[model samples]
Target: MSKQRPNLYYTELDLFILLSKIGLRRKLKPSERRVLVKVYYSEYATPVVPVLITNGKIRLCGDYKLTLNNNLIVDEHSLSTSEELFNGLAEGDKFTKIDLRNAYLNWKVRDEDQHLLTFNTHKGHYNSTRLMFDLNGPPAKWQRKIENILKGIPGVYYL
Candidate 1:
């Protein structure tokens, strides 16, 4: 007999803890809730998929194919730009990377404004009650949330 593969799942409790870190509970609508679930499932299903949410933006994890269409998510110039940014940062004398606790969840999403960042998944499409970044498109409104988080942090850079 063939062994069955593990059906990894994100329990409601697991999602609760994750969403709580971002303070996003009670904010997601039915559709948005469904979408977030789908993301977790898809990512888990494909270990090769890149998973990154850095600087409150979804940083390029790997070359991804947009589920909206089969279009490749990377362009040559963008990859080069990403490489340059990494190379420049690597040359820095000192580096301190700070990752917030559930960064995106820290911001609140109003009921009326949840539809703007909506996205669809193979399971279904849903809007985010919280913010999501589009590295290729204009910054989302939650950019301010990151700004505020950074402001509260004390830092000094001298040339």
Candidate 2:
């Protein structure tokens, strides 16, 4: 009988691709070239967390509650309620659902704020150029960004 192996390694190429998609770039300032965050991995769920190699150990990065409490600003805006969602649809109206894969990664973190999300590894130090998953403020930030974009569009209303 042959045994199947579960993949354990999250290669550097994977990190590179994610960073590329997130538009990550190197900070040229020597003073800024310090590890601001540490990467870690988790297998507590079905899909294993992304792993990064650092000093021969796996590390994961994310602290939602802490990030939210310290870094993000709360807004007055609220998500649509069930009633409001249903009210938006009328008879004969077509409903469409759009799923944006890696939606959080699509949004970029401001250069000034990027340092807040910096992380370090055996390889080097880097900062996030885009919003990362499990960050504290991404949901609110995403809502704000979408709302802003919708404001500029014609015939689009957000409640």
Candidate 3:
């Protein structure tokens, strides 16, 4: 990472390579149509402690002071509320909970919007072909998709 600017970092080269290997991002080649956009980093407090895996050794993550203004709404889809979720449970209800790991990443970003989601690193500019975390629209989009799929199923209610 760069010392001058917390957001500006050289680690993007390695991060981008890892992401590409995991099919989350791709390197923009000369022949492909490029959508050049600037990416900003933001810091937020999370319940989970941050850790970094460097050279196969785990260590406490460094603190950075870069804030990006997402200007996005939370829970824009008006999905289930806490009360609704609780009410769905009965005293003797036998229910199964499914946690879709990396649910957001599973959704592909539209081709047109890929350019706007491009990020620049020391190596090169890359685009997120799939949805990334902290985006306001992803939750709602995912909720809608799930609702549509679960609709008209036998005794399947999305609470």
Which candidate tops TM-score?
3
Tens digit per residue, CA lDDT, model 2, 14-118: 665565443334433443233233235422111112345666543345333333234345545577787865665544355555664347676756766565554
The CA lDDT at 39 in model 1 is: 32
Give per-residue CA lDDT, model 1, range 96-149, as digits (tens). 665543355534456664432333322333444454443222233234444555
RMSD over all Cα atoms, model 1: 13.5
Report the lDDT of model 2 for residue 41: 40
What tens digits encode model 3's per-residue C-alpha lDDT throughout 1-159?
Answer: 112322322343555455444433454454333323323532222111124356663222212222111333345677678786566564435777777634866676787655434444443444556654444566677778888888886545564
Select the stronger candidate by TM-score from 1 and 2.
2
The window of 10 residues in a row where model 1 has the poorest summed lDDT is 60-69
Local distance difference test values of all predictions, in order: 0.36, 0.48, 0.46
Measured against the true structure, the TM-scores of the candidates, in listed sequence, are: 0.29, 0.48, 0.50
For residue 148, model 1's alpha carbon misses the true position, in angstroms, by 6.5
Task: Rank by TM-score, highest first.
Answer: 3, 2, 1
The candidate that wins on lDDT is 2
2 against 3, candidate with superior lDDT:
2
